[model samples]
Target chain A: METTHAARAGRGMTALRRTSGIIAAVTLTTSLAACAGGAIGGGTEGGDDVFKVGLISPVTGPVVQEATAMQRGFELAIEKINAEGGVLGQPVEVVTVDDQADAAKSTQLAQRLISQDQVDYIFGTIPGDTTAAVAQVAESAKVPFSSAILGNAGVCGQYFFPFGEPNASLLNGLLPQMIADHGTKVALVGNDYAFPRGYFADARTVLEELGATVVLEEYSPMGTADWQPVISKIKAAAPDWVLTAVVGADATALVTQADQAGILDSMGFTGVSLIADFYPGLTDRMHGLTLVGRYSDQLDNEANKEFVDAFREAYDFSDPIPSVAANAYEGMLMIADAVEQAGSTEGADIAKALGEGEVENGVFGGGSFNEDRFFMTETARFEIREGGAYVPVETFPADIEGITPRCA
Target chain B: MDAVVTLALSVFTLFGFYALLAVGMGLIFGQLGVVNVAHGELVMVGAFVMFALADVPFLPRLLLAVLIGLVLGVVIERLVLSNLYERGFLATLLAMWGVSIVLREGANAIFGSTPASVRAPIQENIEILGVSYPLYRLIIAVVALAIVAAVLLVTYRTKLGLVVRATVDNRDMASVLGIPPRLVVTGTFAVGAMLAVLAGALQSPLLGVTPMVGAAFLAPAFFAVLLGRAGSLPGAIFGAFVVALLSTVLRTYLNETLAQVVLFALLIVLVAVRPNGIDWRKVQWKPRTQPAQVAA
Candidate 1:
């Protein structure tokens, strides 16, 4: 918004302030198209002969820990890929920037990456809204963009490749068994944000479709300290289990306060983005809870074992690695393969290759996109163990077909 | 009925912490004429102290946090803030703002950014009206309010209170009478910081302790301090009550988003109407002498 306002003021005529500034708008769009000529060409005219991509991560905000994990996984992937003959016969160059989980900052950073850094592709950020912001910028610049986070499958464009879990895969894999085992009555609670609201909206449909009743739906603002009133409401509703989408600090506060209030003991608690990143804050409280997501370090696979061992050794990490980190690892490998298959250092070629090729022995098992450019990674059910390990319990295959349209 | 009961309890719980925060802010704003913009970070310091000393018993941990707050408050005042007060309000405010960044980033570097927690000193569920409430919450609230009352008594009813008030009213005159205004300012700022730290320690068990958590406490406490008359400690407590009650009631009836919007709007309206702030004790009636003279 700050950039837009500045650009508008620079070109806008005072007489046309109240009306449409068509002249300024046209000039800006024309310049934008001209600036995107590098992407249109097969190469960036760089002398280095390196495949470069920019990462806009949120390193200092509510999702800082998750972002850090993703960065580590991303870096590790590049390190391993470069060590093994490199992508397109040259090491991948990654220019990283922090966007603080803010959409506007993300848009600015994405623009900077495309224009100033002259990168072939863009990656990252957490949550759906920031992805949308980066996607818009990536689309405008004609840069292939992707992230290793869950979102609605509908966020599609020609230059987008999502190598992470989507809402459909998450709910389809987890809810049926969850509802069958834990009665029909459910409570939907989360931080009142675009992602959680949309997530719970999808969860609500899945629950009802599985012959369940959503007893209560509550969303509190982010950074809420006193959750007693909300807890009181949830208790009064008396649902069989609580499906929460609260993340970051609020996630810890809600779960901790809920445990103190005896809600976790009385009713079951399970949600996406719940157990792993928050394990330190919610130690023994998360012991028995089970959740489903795309990636877990505990997966009984050879590639996963290598990735997990390498990730732990590199970071000296002991706690449960977040799904985002695992997805970042897979996403980077997929991009590297796409670059190799495209056989060019062009954004258009890379995006095309991403659409055409399957993940070649990446962690989370090799799979292709399920039609609408959404990765069809198999989901796994994991029980939270005492030592911050998401002990894998069940696997949901990547069998979902067709585009299940979620956008108009 | 349970909703009403819950709302009331929630407000009471919220008010305890807000009162602590606002009174501290009110003191700094009132006595030193400097806004301690880093006051919220002071709260984070208390929380991190609790997180770092998880092995210590809760009560001793809280006391250590308060002691740290006192020393931190004095050291900060002497090093960064003491000289800035004479430069201007903006200087002092900016200095405190810089202090806030240092404290926040310092905590982040030491503790890492993952959310941490402290065990509550007490844990049990007790019924209040018809609702089951945490005994720790109730005890903490009462303890906080009791601390506020003790401060109030010391400020209003003690001989030291008279000396402090005289210094604030006319520092030059008080200085002439052998009262060191510098010492008073430093002491008041330290006490204010200690109060905020105390609030944070008590509330740590309920919070997801992070370097960024302090930013959330600043706005409500800012409003609470603003809704009171300058230098009126009781008025600050009342402002805290109003902010807490209004927010809790709105949140009870509406969603969290709507509640925040309505509460912000209400605060804006209140601030616009009473810029000097609300003092119910100052309500007085005057006998009408004339129908009025519209001043042109």
Candidate 2:
């Protein structure tokens, strides 16, 4: 009789525990539902009065440096504008999406920013593929979009504004001087892709015009593990200068291997889109490397100093600002000035104002838009100093000839 | 002549790395009959482990990576794979794939996808046959070959090897013989995982450590598995060497895109001609009198 009574008590306890679990689940579900509803309703409040801007960047991939720099530039610009009473008497807001340099994901995120977040303007992106994807979405949605790093002509569209110096303009100004100083023979090593190929095509024209021969043109697939063969080939070719169209980890690997092979100690390493952000990690290997860029940490200009100071103060970002970030910073400030001059938040109006020359005091000074919607800005050349920082060697004036598109 | 010597050294160095990856992948497929989609993640785990222990010397860091990989393999086998063992091939494949996604996203979430680099302990250049080569690459090649030899000895010359071979041949028969198949499965997977981690740790300096670095090795490893005898260890190593040789030679002479095209075409021809890969001599094709049935 005592055993039976104990069994009955155990069953009752089990039933109580089951009931409590169900109750807890229901309470949690109810709370989540309420929170989601509140979030949706909150986004709808003020509607058109709130100017929402969406930023698409590769925040977690091999291009994190470029993404982080772009984020800082956007944040700094947004903060400054908000402090001075934002556009149209409403505060500006930003939504950042990490594309991770994937085109399909970029499309999904761009659509979400447009349909879900109801973002009015789209500001983006570091990679060529992601930039093209975002630009397509913005063009369809009639949202003002600006690209910060992509300089390819294929990505240019009606509603898209490219703020970086295009490959054509960059190569046109930088290569002649390189050929004159380095040698008449060049070896081109790049990843097998459209961006690198496009840069090579543009550079080839300039090289041929300057009477320099491309000794060898080799392309490796992305994520290639071994580069010794390519290094051996480069050494065999013995070009006066090695022009690398590689980026991210491949760029690092090529530079590292070349240095290890003592090729950097012998030849001039110069090219378009071979970023130097990863150079600091390879301080001992960067003695003979030079790259053409728009922003350098060792620039002697007051404008650059002020921008750098404000950037550090605002984002607490201590590293040398990538050239792409400076492009984004200037792009954001230019967008703000255009919106203020247009006196409206409409995409077309702001684009028109931007075209009509509303933003003059750019980060680098002298910023204007061409018929192709590409930003015509100054390009600078920098060589790696004794330590790791890049020091400015030369600066090119803004071009009126503008960017030549690779496509219709 | 110097260039030829350099090219030969490169092919040899890459062969060791590729062999490590292929052998581990083959062992799992042969014994477990489950294609471990999470194999690449195991490789990533190894790289991250080395990055975490960057201050330590290479051998100790590599040993730690092996231990961690073994623990992880055991845990995965017990908690997830053990239940799915009887659930058929599709179920196991999907489960392993889900695990792969979880691991990749987990690394991204925890480590923030920032590129972490490993400073090679041996940073000098060594001259080989009048050609200068990175000293670290040479070390990796030597260590990898040693590892391959050791694993071969362990698998072919031990009591444990006999049990593992029995389990691979027929799990039910092995179980009926009182040799627990579960223990064999767990042990084989642990060893495979250890090899993968070691390979990743050794190659981290050359590749530049990133969360997605393992994906680059995944396709080639799978190709090696397909080219070799599926259930044979020696065949897998031979297949790795062949694949590595083709890749190096073609990539040297032609562009990467064309090289991949030719490589895939070669794989198709091989599959059509010899379905058992290079291990047809070991396992004879026998006509089945009974229809295959699902395990209860």
Candidate 3:
């Protein structure tokens, strides 16, 4: 009788536990889906009088610093534009989505921004993958989308307007000057992705064209912590300049590991689009490090100064303004100009205007969309100082025009 | 010669970090028969703890992290894992998966998605055999090895070790013999968690401390555990060293993308060949008949 009772209790316990597990799993899945779904839904639905511009930023992932900077810049532009009687005689309303740098999440959020929020114009983000995802949504929706920092992969087409340095332009605009200053023998290190590989291909062509030799090239998977093996190879190669496109947290690890291994002492390090967000953390290690970007905080111009001053007044002025912020801020201005030129907030109309209009005097040293519908801006070089600050060293003319995309 | 030494040291350094992760994960799996997908999150929590205690010195912060891991482990085991212990592997895995998501998202929500970091206590480079390397990296490697040794000693020499071994070997028989299987499993899990947290705290200076940073370490650690003896601590440690050396060498010689492809292919071959991954169960460890007979 006792054995029977124990057996019955054991079976009952198993059933109970299984049921609880199922319930827990269901609850968690449902909750997560709800949380992710609900976030992109609650936008204050604006009437035709308001111009809603959806800004997709990776506010919660590996590149949060860059994303936050982009967010701040967008907000600053909104504040300034609103102060100046708004865009297209309507109050420019901004809807910010946290993409988290995850492509899947970015796609979901992009759809939400377009369908649920009814955003008129959309601004793409810093991380290449997220920007690409957002671009897909904008293309399908026929919305005017502009990316401040898309990778060289030409992920944007048709309705999208990309103004930043694509890999070809970035390499052409920056490498020649770097090869001239530092020696021609250059080593490339970057994340093993299409963007980095594409940039490296561009670098080799540009560097060799400039009468420089490509010494060593190394690529690591994203988020790799151990860089010793690569660093050893780099030391052996002893290249005149080491350029890295390794980004986000992986960049942090590589720099830290390289600094530790004393690889930084042997070579002059230069990177493409690296120094802005991570400047503070890398202050002590930035003795010989140089980077190229379209905008710098040290730009000595009235427009830059005004933008900087306004940024300081609005946010943590003590914090360094990353170049990405300038790019994003300029992107917003470009959108406003496009809207004004088009005389309508309609996606097709704005995209047309974007191609035709010129951002006469924005934060990114004033430029206009070219024949290829890419932003044409002068690139600048900066040397990082010991105290986590950068000094503008040189500026290149906006000669490197955007590439004609062949992506289907 | 210098290249060889640097490569060896690099592999060794990586192995130290992987050992902690693999052993901790192996311990949980050996005792409970469930892969704790939340193992990496425990490491992440440790990194966060170090970030929180930035004002505190590195050594004290690490000790505090271990304590936090212990408390956290106990709570997780008692509230969630204990009920799922007999509910089969799939149930436990799903539960742990849920736990991992909650911890990762909870961190994101609380920490506000910004990557946080702690300064390395030893900022200068140390010269070893005419090669300059980060002193902190050397220290982390040594500390991790010491932790592995400590865990090995506790597992092999103590009365609790015998109970754990018996429980792992035959849970029903061990339970019938008056060994509290739940307590043994919970205690082992806690110890494993504490070690993982310590590894994370020690390596915090070297890597970026983001909410999702743990995902980076998860694959290598899992590979180490997979290639090692499933229930053997020593096997796990040895396997981690092998994996680290292989990964370092491959990544050095080939491009990172190609290296990963090769590594996974190699792992698949190894899994097929070994089937049970170098069985350590065949080796007999004579347990003391009495608790008093166990070594100090």
Candidate 4:
């Protein structure tokens, strides 16, 4: 009788616990659904007078810092443009979407921006994978898609406009320079992902063409903690130069590992995404690290200074605004310029104006987009030093171009 | 030669961390028959505690980190795990999984989703076969080995060890025998959680502390537990070393994703071949002794 009563009591408690669990699960599911729904359907409706641009970024993921900066830059540019009588006398309003740095989420956000919000233009995404996903949506919908941070060649096609250095071009241009200046042998290290592998392959082809020997290519998973194995391989290879293409949290870890292992002093290290944004965390370890990009905070140009100053005054954060943010800001301004030139917010018309051979001076030392909708501009390389941020070491002329033959 | 030495050093260092994680899971599942899926979260908490202690100037940060891990382990066992005692496998599994999500998300909210890391205790590199390696990793390996040895001694030689063993065999019988099985179970859980904390605190300097970082450690730890047989300490440690070595070698030679898939497939195969685990026979089930016939 006692055992039966105990069993009944236990069953009763179990039932109560299960009931609580179901309620909690439902609440969580509903909250998440509502947040996603709000992102897709919560904008002021039928307001055709306002030119709405959708800005998508990883606002709450591993790359939130970069995403936040890009968002700020876009907002700042829109503010400035609106102050100057707006685009085509209609105030430009941006509808921001948080992709959370996930590729699938980026795709969904792109669709929402196009079909749901009816945005005039879409901009911003840092990682290559996220950009690639968004590019497809833009192309299918025949909407003008311009990216600020992701500059992989794979992202460039009919409907996409990349406002920064394409992966292949950056590698082709930088690798040969590295080989000519340093030596013929180099080691490559990067996060194991699509962007790094794609860019490294480009660098390998360029290095081989320049009679350089590829010593070793080591990859660590994204967010990997240990670098001993890879660093050990780098040491063994004894390459004259090392090239890296990791981003976000992994970027910091790799730099920290390299600094700890004394790889920076032993070999010349160059990377594509290692910039002022990633350098601050490295402290004294930032010295002698080489990287290539479109702009640095130290670029002595009026437009660059103005953008930096405005960002500093607005954000009030001590950290230097990342170049990714600056590029996004500039990209937004360029899109608004193209829209005004076309005198319409139609995607097709804006795309044509963007490629109409007009010399538009906006930011990052202005250059006109070529027939391919990518700028044939000077590439900037900087050497990071202690306390002093990424100081510009050299700049190649805009006319000097290198095209990567597509790999089969 | 340098490459070989470096690879070997990496394998050993990785083995140390993996072993610590595996042992923690082994203790919980072996002693309590409850799979604490939130084992990795306890590690994350330990890492954060180390991050907090990083600025203190006086005592060795490493020691302070271990102490923090111990406290966290005790707290988690007392507050969360004690209630789940005697709960069936499915219930405990679901509860722990939910706890993991809450802890990970809560960590993101508190830590702001940014990766934070503490500096390695020793920054100097040790040269082996003309290759330089971080001395901190070597220290981690030594410390991990020491803890393992101490745990083995305590479990094998102490009176508490006998009570724990009996409790694991039959909780109801042990409690009826005046063992206070609940206290024993909670104590073991706390110790297991502490082991996880130690592993994370030691590893935090090498790997930055991110909310989702626990997911990475969890997979390998589970693989180790499954491969070693559910409850064997020695089996778990051996499994951890083997898996770590295999993963490191495969990653070096094959594509990263392929390596992960291959390792998980291997674990599945091991489990299939030995459903009762590697040391199934060692798990003793107490015989049902007839209650003394009530006097007529």
Whose TM-score is greatest here?
1
Q: Measured by TM-score, how close is model 2 to the native structure? A: 0.84
TM-score of every model versus the real structure: 0.90, 0.84, 0.85, 0.85
lDDT of 2 by residue, A280-319 (tens): 4455566556777666767666667877899868766555
Q: Is the docking of candidate 3 incorrect, acceptable, medium or high quality?
A: acceptable
How are the candidates ranked when ordered by DockQ, highest leading? 3, 1, 4, 2
lDDT, candidate 3, at B248: 86
Candidate 2: tens digits of C-alpha lDDT, residues B10-118: 8898898989998888777655666776778888888888888878888899889989989988887888788986675556666776777788778777764445566
After aligning candidate 4 to the native by TM-score, how far in Å is the CA of A111 from where it should be?
2.6
List where candidate 2 sits over 4 angstroms from the true fold. A1-42, A45-49, A58-65, A95-118, A133-142, A272-274, A300-318, A358-362, A386-388, A399-403, A406-408, B169-181, B280-296
Model 1 over residues B89-137: C-alpha lDDT tens digits? 6576668878888999999898888889888877788898878888898
True contacts kept of each: 0.46, 0.28, 0.36, 0.21
| Best candidate, DockQ | 3
Recovered native contacts, candidate 1? 0.46
Q: What lDDT is reached at residue B116 by model 4?
A: 64
How is the predicted docking of candidate 1 categorized under the CAPRI scheme? acceptable
Inter-residue clash pairs, candidate 3: A163-A375
Question: lDDT per residue, candidate 1, A1-408, as tens digits?
Answer: 112322322222121121224334653565455334322122344444578888867877677887898888888888999999887787777788777777767777789788888888888888678888889889888899988866563477888887667776777767777777778899888898777877787787777778899988989888887788788878889898898888888888999899889998898789863758888888888898888877777777888999999998998888888877888888888888888888887878888888888875667877786557778777788888878888878888874522244332
Ranking by TM-score: 1, 4, 3, 2
CA shift at A15, candidate 2, in angstroms?
44
Stronger candidate by DockQ (3 vs 4)? 3
